[model samples]
Target: MDVQSETVPRDARHRVERTRARARYDRDTVHAILDAGMLAHVAFSVGGQPFVIPMLYARDGKTIVLHGSIASRLMDELADGVPACIGVTHLDGLVLARSHFDHSVNYRSVVVFGRARAVLDADEKASALSRFVDALIPGRAAESRAADRTELAATQVLRLAIEDASAKIRSGGVKDNPADLALPYWAGVVPMRTRYAMPQPEADLADAALPASVRRLLAADEAAA
Candidate 1:
């Protein structure tokens, strides 16, 4: 693990004001959170009407890759180089405290600010699509059939470089008032996790056996558990 203590330079837009101790501007921290997440809530506007859409995305180094149908309004609008804010979050636990005011949830979240540009080149678009697949399950892209020309043409790909980003995280036990510690209420953290269950194969592919990517995914999940 490459642990970098250097943090991203913060300005008014990317700085954390409230609970500043929970804020993190390190590239490694932000990247880790983005990699762990599968969905991104993208905030943008069209003709002054604001919209926030949930999108599937993959982090490629300093850029985030997104794909959608070419006919999609959001995709078309973003491709024209509009400023956007992308957010990803993971709920880690329920923090129960002696008082309701102190009750909170342990989470890791990131916000990225950038402008997205359309990926026009065929080869670059194809590689971007592959990254999305591999991000979900390592090596799955190579095992699966590649997208055909027509399919690739119909799909729109966009890349948003990480211009400014910040991560906010909360972890560990409850923080209850010292006086409230004597209260009868139980206080602790109930950890939460997202894990993969056994894979269910399609009936048509009966007994075909699982691919190496799936097996590897399951093994990694089990090891983490």
Candidate 2:
């Protein structure tokens, strides 16, 4: 399969109809959004019923990896090769406009289209799970113990290739009407961000030192802040 970053053919399926100017197809731009995101809302239909569920995901080259309990119906359906739409979003700020109709939000979001397949091979599934753990926090997979046979057997890992995708982004100041500028109402952007608080340890492990992976994550979060 062709990598989404290499070529994302734009058609009615993945087009941004509302605001065409905000649609972006560049490789770096699309990959950057995926890399920054940790959670994705996956939408798929079973029979005639539709479902949208939030799941933790990891971007692995051209595919997104997700795992769940083996007995979960959602996981079973997705593993059966159902067509899925995954969405990831990061809210940059709240756009406040003088007029309520013009109020909007500044965000970076991506919509991906693909069919999911179950990772049945033991080694492949384990590798995918490891990559997922590391994606959340770099080096975490190495710091933690590997899953045992029983644990691995109870989990279902699925991979969705990025067959077609597109990113829509809105940034900068609030877009308010020129006439509304002189109004008494305040119109500006209230910036928003996700930051990590001080780490909390388990009650039994109160004296344990912070792991290398956690220290690195804290340092990165602090630098970004």
Candidate 3:
């Protein structure tokens, strides 16, 4: 929501661009896709070698913040304003078509290009780190103790000022050759979703408070699926 509509890059694509509706221009749609994803792939180059590392992240309005140990190689370099390409994707289903060529996956993805900066302030870094934890475990942060000085020193946080970004989404059922419609083989989408099971209380725990935030996440996470 922090990104202004005008600040986004041109929505036009090259000749090789995929389906037109596959492209998303609205900011809210892009943010929603990003929010649904729990992880992001950070792509960058060093000494001309391109690399992409998948890591956990949290979005605070406009900026995408990544937290890692100070000793982490990529995070350290990224804090130095390294040019980076970041991608986040969510796979929604598997489309099964009669022909192998028609098989595809339904997904939503976003690619962002920006300059990275290290979070220097103790307060800002701490807050960003908290958001990262909450994104994954909702009430986990509230249930735990705050980071101490030593912990803060050992942590490295980086923020990417997303200047140019684009989101592409693919959904619905399979696309097949018009002539192949007569084929008898089934053709449809196998929907994929994240679900949850009943809470399994920890063995060592007794009477306890299961925070509402955690309860919601427990219901949303379909790890068994």
- Can you give the TM-score per candidate against the true fold? 0.95, 0.95, 0.87
Q: For residues 6-120, could you state the per-residue lDDT of candidate 3 as single tens digits? A: 4354644211166757877567776888787779999888889998999898877778898889998878778878888789988889999889998999988887777789887
Per-residue accuracy of model 2 over 1-225 as CA lDDT, tens digit each: 233445566677887788987888766777789999889999999998999999999999888999999999999999898899999999999999999989999999998889999998888888988998998898999988888778889989999988888889999998888888899998889989888888899998789999999999899989987
Report RMSD for candidate 3: 3.2
Give the winner by lDDT: 1
Clashing pairs in 2: none
Candidate 3 residues lying further than 4 Å off, grouped into runs, are: 1-3, 11-16, 197-203, 206-209, 220-225
Which residue runs of candidate 1 sit more than 4 Å off their true CA positions?
Answer: 1-5
Residue-pair clashes per prediction, in order, are 0, 0, 0
Model 1 TM-score, 2 decimals: 0.95
